[model samples]
Target: MKRFVILIFIISLLFTGCWDKREINQLAFVQGLGIERGKDDMIHLIVQILKPGLLAAGGGGAGGTGGGSAVGKPYAVFQASGVDFAKAFANLNDELPRSLFMQYNEIIFLEEKFARSGIYKTLDFMTRNPEFRRTAYILVVTGGSLQELFDLPNTKQLERYPYKEVLGMIENQKNTSSSYVCDLNEFLEMLEIPKEAPITGRLEIVKKDGKAIGVRMAGSAVFNNDKLVGFLEEQDTKAIMTLKNKLRRSTLTLDKGLKGEKVHISFVVIKAHTDIIPKVKGKDIFFDIKINIETHMNEQESKYDLTEPKNLEKLQLLINDKIKQGIEHALFVLQKKYNADVVGFINILHQKNPKLWKEVEKDWDKIYPEVKFNVTVKSIVRRTGLSSKPIQPR
Candidate 1:
């Protein structure tokens, strides 16, 4: 009996209530962050915090209708400055009533000036901090005020939260295939590799009538390690995504020469893949990119019987040529213009020919600009859509 009582007493002692637990109301949850360079050699930090009460109140009562008008903005914005990223983040507490929490942070925006100056400080802070989630997306703000981006009014009525709207813009990349996005984890991983450079999706303020109304996400910011080197235009960005096998779906519109006239045709890409092969001849090196694409005819402007075997072959050839041109242009910009290997050429070389990679690794920067590239594209039009030919005038 005595042993049973002692054991029961010991078990009871283990039932202590929630220690080191913080109440939700006492912590401010950050939705997004913007980093920029400030005056006086300080770093500026902007944060968007979610207001739970306001959001809950904004949600309609029983049916999805009324309370949205009564509630003010569902989030608040705050800014601060410090000598370093860590100190700048810490300084937010001075203006905040609750402890700032970052577990829910979804996106991070780096101002162009800050990124150009070098993002090593910001990258260092993010990598060392356990509070920041690795999956949160990172972007570079180009040619705009970071504060204005944060202050964008949710006028579109498409999304209630400003951060959600911006996040949705990044998500749109999968459909448009004109931009590229990467999370903090991916960016950090690329930074760790000497041969690989890091790139982030580009963000800019959308204005109409000279007033900032929303934000736009397009193109990409190319970086040589932690410093922003240049920006890739939308077309180049799309080509890079295709070459890297990151494109899910996209539409290509090209003017085709048919019957001594030009006809516009649109192809909806269904599936696409690229094979990069590295060739070595003695000491000379070359890369061959073989791109295979599967697409469907979406639109045809003129009454060209494309269903015919000969016409279909010509259409496929045109598509192949168009894709080849895009890939070539992208390569020209990356190699000849920027001299930055944002593509996975290093990875291909390391995997396919590690021995050769070792010999040329040191001179990759100098040789990359002069490296020759051969591109071959093949496209198949699997479906002609509902009608094989354009409808004739009745």
Candidate 2:
């Protein structure tokens, strides 16, 4: 037995081979990837690679400032065109001295046009490749091209890390309070299901002073199966987020119960639970959504005294109404206009009442639009923060 154990250990030691090993200088770490379908009917691939010099500079602190500033373009962008994804990736590698490593890639930006056409090929290539991680975040670029978004001087260049910058924007769960950060795995999983849709973050420029300043994560790109269908505005996505219990923090603007002024209040979500009560009467089916949210006030811009029980109760009712409005708007756009089930109602049915779902699976699209939604939102304001009223009015 001791000889057998020694033999197994020796075999395991031999399994570690130097054949696949690569040195640091021989491998290039890809931070971001952008894919777009060109007008010439080919795939345009763009990649952002990290440089060792900038990392060295960042690692050495203030003392390593010498000659590091001259190492221009902290990350380099390489573009290539090919007949298909595999060819495009190979062409990208042809342009680089070292192999383009993709395991560390954080973000993949797909053009709206490309995503709308279909993503089966791209997704297949990404998933089949051993080097690409399934967890990488995917964003759909809108209002502009992928190259234009990448060409900006400040983006993925100069001193900042673009991967971290954009990834940070999506990962900042509390600050966003509204954006959908959909990963490749989550998207793939959605594609495998029937009567369900996938949603991703929208990368676009925010206008300032009648001019475009910089790109920000805004809205959501809705997908029905593998093709892009439509986009949900910030307000609509917030409603979906609320239903999914993914609302981290939000600034709710209540236009009621304040007598005159609209109340602008920010709050951190303590807990949000949603229950989809599927109603079935004969062959007719609809959904009743129950959203229970607990939040404490962070900042309030209304003159209502949150300390008073009556006023606070009224404020909570108003908030509940606003939340309902948002949910209705989202349901209208998704179920009526787009007829996409990005809210996972189909999965809810499958989990809760699988027998009914099997019968209704074939005609979910037609059934979904006609389905009625009863959004019941109950919200409470637990804290009033430092001030009970707005600092504006005396």
Candidate 3:
């Protein structure tokens, strides 16, 4: 009985301390959206620091309809500039009462000029900061100022900030490869690899009624060692996603025999697997890529007889062709044009045949462009909803 009483007292003592406790009202909560720009060759930081009271009040009412009005009168938006990012952040301390915290920061936007100038310096601070999360997405503004991107108003169904809205869009879309979140850790990993290149998300603002409506992700910014080498269009990004097996649910529109007519097909990927085989034939090296994809048909624009085996074969061929084309295009762009292998093919090669990779590690970049690849894609369409037939009358 005495021992039990002592154990209860010990448990009670554990709950009595406030050693690291912080009051909610005392600390500032940052939503984790920031924009960096360059002016006069110096760095400028613009942070979208959230106002808790305003956010709470906005969500208090029914239908969550108070975001625009509340955000219009923001709790605080600040900009600071300095030679270094840390110095700039310190400068901000003078302007605000609370410390600049980045625990919840989700997105980082860089102006085109700033990105083109170079992002390595700015990225150093992000990676080194203990308060920052490695999962925060990094983006490049295609053709706008950092302020413009940050100032874009929230116009979403759920009354959230424009920054949060952009993050939500990327999270919600599966067809779009550019929407995949890229953080500092992934970016740094890509940089460390000599053969692999890194890609950052792109954002562009859309204005309506002279007010910022929203910002959309354009594509991806391909980088060759902290330098902006080029950009991958949306189509190219899709191809990259297909090769990397990162696609979730996407629609592919193809010309299905009817000369002028187009067929739209949506697929929900059930399972996807990829295998890379590296072959060394004396002086030549070849890569054999085999991908197995299983999907359920979500939509079909035109009528197709799935019951007939012959028609189903044709549909299978069409899917294979489309997937093949996408892979080929992605490889061409990554190897011939960009000269950067963002798909981690070298890692696969090393895994498959470590002995061969060790010998050719030094010349992998030169060899990568010369290496021939044979890609084979197999797609299985399992089901075509309840009513497989076309809804429109024949």
Candidate 4:
């Protein structure tokens, strides 16, 4: 009986042997992944591979933070091409000595041309792959391709970690621009709804003295389904953020006072909320948007006394008009010009009243452009900043 027990233990040990386990050191860890179309009209996949040896040597800058981003040119670049994204993404295996480890990949950039052509194919592999994280930042390169952007040098950067830089861009702007850092999962979820369009962060290389120095997060890239339609400018993007109920903090620069001597007052939005109310008028569709915003006067160029209740009330009215105008402008550009509904109004209808959505889901696109919107803003001045009134000239 004792011999039988010993034999059973030995058999269990034999079955427990690792058949598919991969060692971290033996794998070629990827830092960033870039996809674009090549001259051959095929998909090109670019990967920034991290060297474990150099990483083990110990380094400062972004490397110390312990992410997959490359420090300087210490990382290797691998380019592979094929007919489809799946084939191109897999072709890198033949070029690298170690197994391609995308589990560490931090960012993915797609050229504007390819993104406009339709990123459905590239997204398929990334989403379906169990190794890839859904949290990786995804951006559309508008100004230049990954090669050109990565080749640039940045002095402000602790090291040339493009992934870290892009991540930092969203991190630093957390207080100013609502959380606009979009990931692959969020984008995929948005694409599932035909009534909603997905927009990703826009990336552009900054050039000075005829040289690319660094990269900047350029607003956002709007997509009509899988194709790139247009972009939301700074103010337009802010308006959308407000409507999405994600505007954590932002300042509104309003031109008030006399026409001949107009003054710009920057109102810091302390709190904001938006409610979308859809109305079905016979066969026509209309929307009633209600916005409530609370702000504090941050900076002023006029002699307006923000401490005064009467003056504050007047200022609130001006802010109301401004907010309404901004929202209207964004709606015009998105609905009239692009015909893209990134606002998710249709989904709102479905959620609020599915029966109604079923009736107009087919013709929502046709009704979208023709649909009229009524925007109403109610604003309040919560507090006066350090000063009660504007700084008078000495």
Clashing pairs in 3: 32-105
Q: Kindly give the number of clashing pairs for every candidate.
A: 0, 0, 1, 0
- Give per-residue CA lDDT, model 1, range 1-394, as digits (tens): 9999999999988886777678877888888898999998799999988766754565632112234644566677999999999899889877898988888898988998899899888888888988899999999987578888877776654666677777777877788886788999998988887778888799877788877887787699898878899888888888998888988988898786555367788888989999999998777788999999999888888787877889888888888988899889988988877788888698789999999999888989988888888899999999999988779999
Model 2 TM-score?
0.88
- Order of all candidates by TM-score, from best down to worst? 1, 4, 2, 3
Candidate 2 runs further than 4 Å off = 1-16, 52-70, 155-159, 206-213, 260-268, 389-394
Q: Rate the local accuracy (lDDT) of all candidates.
A: 0.84, 0.78, 0.71, 0.80
The candidate that wins on TM-score is 1
- Can you tell me which runs of candidate 1 are displaced by over 4 Å? 1-19, 55-70
The most accurate candidate by lDDT is 1
Task: Give one digit per residue, the lDDT tens place, for model 4 in 233-298.
Answer: 777887888888878888888887523267888888979999998888787778889999999878
Native-vs-model 3 lDDT? Answer: 0.71
What is the number of residue pairs that collide in model 4? 0
Per-residue lDDT of model 2, residues 92-189, tens digit only: 99988998888888789999999998889989998889899888999998877676666565643323555666776786745556678788998899
Writing each residue's lDDT as its tens digit, candidate 3 over 66-162 gives 4434535344578888887788877876677777767777777777777776788777887787877888788877655667666665444254455
User: What is the lDDT for 323 in model 2?
Assistant: 81
Comparing 3 and 4 on lDDT, the stronger one? 4
